[model samples]
Target: MPQFSRHSRRGRVMIAIGLSALLLGTSACTRLRTHQGYQVDKLLVDSVQPGIDNRASVEGTLGRPSFVSQFGEQDWYYVSRNMRALAFSNPKPVEQTVLRVRFDPAGNVAAVDRMGLEQVAHISPSGDKTPTLGRHRSLFDEIFGNIGAVGAAGMGGGSAGGPGGGPNGS
Candidate 1:
């Protein structure tokens, strides 16, 4: 059998130590998630003319929304998201905004509502959350903090899902 020399053995040990250090250091480092903030729909919401808010005109004004009509064919939604997660169990929605525009049958602007982050209510992911035992939630409380689940129940699990609970399990 071949035997390793002193220098060769030391070199291998050093390489192993270096690799171990790197792996350990990387693992120790925190994994942070960075997200972009709420950017308004400058194309449509900002430049829209109330009187000229017809379907074609609104489409031209806003280019295309984050979403559009599916069933009723009268509502448009512009959405934006933001998040920052450093040492949390889950990422929180730092900021979120949705611009909802409703049109009359003639396509004239009927109503315009701007919903911001404050308008939303944080819920549980189970989509089956019952009332908690108490309400003295800390800053890092697990409950009453999560932005809720996406396709698990309340938010509706369809492509045409609205803000809250979907059809199957949002």
Candidate 2:
């Protein structure tokens, strides 16, 4: 029969506990960095000039935009964000860059604008039920509200219904 001494078994248990605690301690303070969208190169971006650069040249220099304006003035946006998260929590935007390049009718660059985290909006949802403007009713009212709403003919004032039961009430 195989046997383990008391001291050996105690040492194994102590080692296991210590390893588990060490794993958890390291994971608890782990900081994760996530990069999203276009990576900006200062030198390349600075070279793009208004009136001097057209659609073709801009595309060649900076590649395709992250997104184009859907409505109003012709504009291109290159968005970038640096998100940081710890453990399993939601990532928060630590840094953001939104570069807007506007174009004139001739497809030449009109203006260049840069924005940062100051423009980022943080919103908290209002919860499961959307707040709609109307009269509020209880659960019971919603379930039984339609009971006997119409007359015997289904419609408030109808003779009978389909078949011969029409305008003549045959």
RMSD of each: 18.0, 3.6
lDDT for model 1, on a 0 to 1 scale? 0.72
**Model 1 lDDT tens row, 83-109:** 756554576777778888789888887
Error of 1 at 53 (Å): 2.1
Estimate the TM-score for candidate 2. 0.79
What's the TM-score of every candidate structure?
A: 0.50, 0.79
Tens-place lDDT per residue, model 2, 1-170, is 13568778889999999999999999898999999999998888898999899888888988899999999548999999999999888999999999899999989999989999998777888788888899799999999877776544555454456554566655
Q: Residue 107 lDDT in model 2? A: 92
Q: Model 2, stretches more than 4 Å misplaced?
A: 1-6, 124-130, 151-170
Write down the RMSD of candidate 1 (Cα, Å): 18.0
Q: Quote the positional error of residue 169 for candidate 1 in Å.
A: 47
lDDT minimum window of 10 residues, candidate 1:
151-160
Candidate 1 at residue 56, lDDT?
82
Residue-level error in angstroms, candidate 1, position 132: 18
